[model samples]
Target chain A: MDPARRLGPAQIDVVAQLGVSTVLLGGIYALVSVGLTLIFGIMRVVNFAHGEFLMLGMYVAFWAYTLLALDPYVVLFVSIPLFFGIGVLTYVLVMRGVIHASHNVQIFTTVGLSTALQNAALVAWTGDYRTVRPWHSAVVIRALGMAFNLSQVVAFAIAVALTLVLFAFMKWTHTGRVMRATAQDHDAATLMGIDTDKVYRLTFAIGIACVGAAGVLVSPLYAAYPTAGLQFVLLAYVVVVLGGLGDMLGAMLGSLIVAAVEVVGSYFFGVAWKEVFYFVLFIAVLVLRPAGLFGQRGAETLGV
Target chain B: MPALAPGRWVAVALFGIVALVPAGVRDAYLLDSVILILLWGALSAAWNVAGGYAGQVSLGHAAFFGIGAYSAALMTARFQQSPWLGLMLGVALSIVAGGVIGYLSNRLRGPYFALSTIAFSQVLLIVASRWRGFTAGSEGIPVPFRPGFWTLGLGHVAWVYLALGVAVLYYGVAIWLETSRVGYQLAGVREDEDAAEALGIASRRLKVYAVTLSAAMTSVVGTFWAQYVGFVDPFYVFSIDLSVRFALNTIIGGIGTGLGPFLGSLLITSLETYLRATFSGMKTGFAGIYLVIYGTALILVVRFVPEGLTGLAARLRVRSSRAHA
Candidate 1:
């Protein structure tokens, strides 16, 4: 009787749940950060409205599910393209003017954009937090000792897939080569007959589309509100900066580390202490490695 | 100058009329809104010193504001101190905090400063929310009705307006700062840091000075705010919406102008009042819609009338005066 009571089922489950939850959280972090890293890699613009794009994508999922009865994952087809168009529009109409403007104008314009988009969503959706639920259960896997939700699994799969696709494109494609060249030296790329404007438009669109996809994927697991994406967006900024402004590989590794710190700290202290953990991590990184975890000397100027 | 131009005398007269609103208007709700407008205007003007003049563009002045409110409230409520002493201590704390934040982002340009300020504000919010022993956590500490001439009460709206008058006095100081040597130096720093450095101006010192000054002024407003509202809460103090409104007030009126914040506040206040009156049920949604429209208006203004209302007034003055001659 003592042997049977020693290893309680609940205690075993708790240990297993912590391990599984931490890994799943890391996947979510990676997904949120990938697009941010891509945008920084090429344009060097911080995309302050990046979170707004995610919010818009959430609305897309909500509307499609509410109106058309489309699955949340199916809504991705609509969100990705729509967000990409908006991204291109943003790059062409707004970013073009402020590309060479002072830091004041850069921040002012982007902040202005963020405010506009956020308000637009507010007016449209009226601050209601909505969630899309499928007919069946979303939790699919129960392996070893813990269960995995369908949304989280799908989010992880999509993230990994997109990451691989982006990696392959950057390594092989001619247009991708031009993007790298432009990121390295804008004038040199222009002189080399590579159209930098087109590159910028595509890069920005793709980056935004990535967030759009992430939004749709996570709509099932998380409630979508006007300000839902804000916390993650802020965290993504910290991750991007920590990874080095424009380094893709740095983003993935940085996400893992940041996730580990956040999840582990949250477990020990409480859920509310998560932000404290991240801020401390950010400050520590800033103090010890000012250029970032993997940033080069000149990479300080990576993001505009 | 144009014949219809509201001259400096008229502006003075307008403020005089405004100062007597509590006496004139007996409604507590309307008077409270008036106090809110003035407070927001003062905070915006303070923000402009660092953001518009020094080009720091901080999105986190709420930290100082929140800290000041809590400090003042905590002291007056628990320690039984006078409001005036609490006010001074609040400003001092904000100055120190501002100095540290400004130093951290001193080397970084543009959005980094804004981002860091946001970070600091977030941290402040977290601390205020978590430190239940001091802050009372999310429930917030209530300042009781300690109504005395010096205690800063919760009952009389007149006293609140009077406390707000001190904020207006500081706004006067800010106007003076605009025309002074520090103002020009700050402008020089904003336009070209290297050129200012070459001209023997200590750009970093001016930036830190402006930001610290901004923090001090904002904290003073916060002290009065806590007293007027009879409470102090982290969300109420350190909200990003307040920060956005600070930037909006300055930008909508005229980004770098001395009187921009006043005009912007007047316009926005009137608009908000009217909206609340007419669309009370749908205020939040309406405000969201209005913000979108306002954003478009801002873009248009930024594109065509970048100099803002003050510039327009100045232009009309020039044209009409020339015509008269």
Candidate 2:
């Protein structure tokens, strides 16, 4: 390589540092967007409260850490099951009616739920920004001239591992197959004696559980606040849409792309500029590729 | 004009009563609440044009609202111009922005369109908060309390009248839309886009028109809000909560009916005001008590009465009529 073309060691370090942070950010984003995409893919209903669920998870973990002196990661065990039940109850009470209702109803119902949940949290927590300080949170892991927190690294590991597990379950498990069948064709799945309603409820439960898990993992990384989910949720939308709505693989890829754009864009244009770029990209994607990168032809206009 | 429906008559009565609120209630606090109702009612009505009639369901309307508020705020504070000129500028800019947004999102439906509006609004929010040099950022721009006809008003009563006038204008627009041919076409577009397009309704054009008109009306009210508040903050103007509030007011009242948003705004804003006053001294969880009720009401309303309060009233009236028959 020409000496002029070759990057200096410091420049290489910067690139690697950005790359690692991007993946770390992408991992959490992927975790969130995966659940959102799955919900949309299976139920064709967007969970506007996905981030709130994550916030709830963060709160749970925060509480667990504060009251019981438990490690934040241990709360994952508590959150997954708790959020799964909450998810099932949500579907039964709320989503069931709107599953067949108008798009506006579906959208508003969830938006209402989100507003209620967010405000309820605000009421409960007093809009305070609570942080989870795991013992390992301060430990910096340095490798190859890059530095990151142990908690963040662990969060990234759990995120990627859970994503694999989700992929495997979808590929191998019977419930996953049924969910996929329901996603592919609701009527056909019903005609095949697949118990499509059960599949939908299960899909919603799993999606919520995934986000809940992500939220617990996120507790140590981000501050827990009532509106904390707002930022993540919008970013999740961008990632989900960029990857193609309702596409798991696309969500993962979109997460990386979006994180890269944000990280690199932030490096150059400042923090606010990064948001502007992503939002513009979000609109661009919607306008130009409504079906998303990995989505089916009719996914964007599903149930229209 | 179309034959006066029961809802239309009720709306007229509602506005008439609301117009005289300042006369009966002399308390500044009470007047402030009424002004909030009228301002929000007007905004909800404006949002209803595109969201209700054309079925756009924008969650990004704060961008336009901010555009108007800041345009006037910046003009009055920075350029030393009359707010009326700012109003004209704001409307023109809002029109262009609305047209662009409507055109861009012409083909989007449901959640996709809603999300796009949010993204668009977020962009504005970020810009407003970040561009400190241009917008004064979150510290906000203070509009001098220049009390005159050119300044837009003199006292609390004058504001109530001003707000009432704007609200009535929005109501008139909604009535016109419901009665006009363009309104019918917009309705057609909302109901079934493909079918409406097949009928040569020019769906895209009508949708854009609805959004453009909606944006203009919203911006006009934005100017009034800026002047009324005498301070303009990016957070207050460009927040998603404001956008969602518009939708919530419309949906809770009765989207597509044109008269629903005002009713919705009246009920919801009153409830919010009452709740805030009741919980003003509370702490912790009580801090968001008003929002909790507001959100729960929204959920319960959407779930049980998707047609909204007006729709429920209409239904009740129909049942009574059937019983009599």
Candidate 3:
């Protein structure tokens, strides 16, 4: 390779260091996008408010940390159920009505929910970034002459394990099978007495629970703020669309691709140029493969 | 031209009262609050076109508003050009930009379209912040009034009323658009794009027109904003809060109805003004509480009275007519 394109010894070491970190980041993104995709698949409604749920969970963890001095990890027991209840309540109160409302209503209600949640956080937390500081120094493991952080490794493990469980539940379990049935054909499921409302409520709850879990898992790695979820929200959208909306595996792959793009682009060009590359990637993918790389046919098109 | 509706006459009367507000109110603070209400009302009304009319909810309309404000600020601050001309140029640019983005995303679904608009707006914001030479970065560039009859001055009651007049004009135009044939087509497209397209409505073209026209109107307000404050900052100009507030106004008032934004703006903006004045130091928290209320209100409205205040009124009017019959 040319000197410019080729990796020197120092550069090679840096690349090796970054490689595992990027993959770990990408794994967390996959986890995020899977939650989003599951909701989209079941309801055929894009939950624009998905990110706010993550914010809400982080805040839950924040309060748990501040008020009770609970370790953020320990608070997951509370966060998951609380967030799940909120999610189910959202479906019952808002999403049910919107499911039958026009496409505008769907977007409007969810966006409203997102805005309201974000502002509520802003008003409550005052836009400050918070973190439950790591219990130990940021430690790294060396394998095959490459290094990865303990935090990243733990997050990556949790993410992968949760994804596997989700995949298995969806494939093997009865409720999961019903959920998949409803996702594939809502009217058919209704005809078969599959209880779609329950599915929707459960699916949304599960989605929220997953994000809440991810929030606690990653809080040690990064700071939490009122608007901290905005970046991830945007990234999740890219992943879902790139992974092919409503495709679980596609979302996982798309997450990797997006993380790779952002990290590599940031490395090669600069941080500012990362978004430019993502935008170009988004447009190109949209033009060439509208259904996304692994997307189902007729799945990506607008309904109304 | 069609005569104004008899019911709208009441609205006109309310406007008449508002028009005399500066004259009746001597306190500058009161006048300033009144001006803010009118400005928000105008901005919300403009937002209703693309969002309420065409059913493409743009969560980043502040981008147009910001661009327009900055364009006018730059023009008048640098070249000493007449602000009225600057306002026109700003509107032109906003229209062009809105058209391009609207056209690009016209085919996509709602959430994707919304994301694209946000992406565009965010990119603009990033550029504005980073390109400090032009935008003055975070410090912001202030423009002092070189007051003339038409230079768009600050610290003047007349200019406030003038801005109010321009806003009223825009509100009227938006109302007119809502009742027009193009308006019908846009609404049809919004309701069912394929159905509208099947009927030869040219949904994409109409969407582009609606988006562009709304952008132009919003940009006009942006220019007025620059003149009112006599300063341009990226933070205030490009904030997502502005877009959220605009959406809140439209939804609360009566989305899809001509008079919805008017009532929504009036009610919501006044509520915001009251909150700001009452809760001096805890403003952020207060604002958050207000958002929670606003969103709760929106969800409730969508659930029960999705047509909003205007829809409720229409129902009342029909009920009374039937009772009389």
Residue-pair clashes per candidate: 1, 1, 1
Tens-digit lDDT string for candidate 1 (A1-304): 5877658897688767876776677676776787878887787677777887887777788789999999877777777788889889888888776665556656666667777888888777778889888753365788877787777777777776777787778779988888999989999999999988889889988888888887887777788888887888878877877887778888888887777778778888988889988877776665456566898854442224
- Place model 2 in a CAPRI quality band: medium
Best by TM-score: 2
What is candidate 3's TM-score for chain B alone? 0.91
lDDT value, residue A71 of candidate 2: 93
Task: Output the better candidate (2/3) by lDDT.
Answer: 2
Clashing pairs in 1: A44-A304
Put down candidate 3 lDDT per residue, A1-304, tens digits, no spaces: 6897566777787787667667888899988788898998788788878888877777777678778888766777777788788888988877987786766677778877887888788787787788766553177788877777776787788888888899899989999999999988889999999988889999998998888777877777777887777777778878887888788988888988988898888888878667666666775665466567887554445552
Q: Which TM-score values does chain B get in all models? A: 0.88, 0.96, 0.91
Please list the C-alpha lDDT of all candidates, in the order they appear.
0.76, 0.87, 0.79
- Give residue A247's error in model 3 in angstroms: 1.3
Show the lowest summed lDDT stretch of 10 residues, model 3 chain B.
B279-288
Which DockQ-derived CAPRI band holds candidate 3? Answer: medium
Q: Kindly list the per-residue Cα lDDT of model 3 for residues B15-100, writing each as its tens digit.
A: 78778877778888777777877788788888998888888788789989998888888888777788788888888889789887
Q: What is the TM-score of each candidate against the true structure?
A: 0.89, 0.97, 0.92
DockQ versus reference, model 1: 0.42
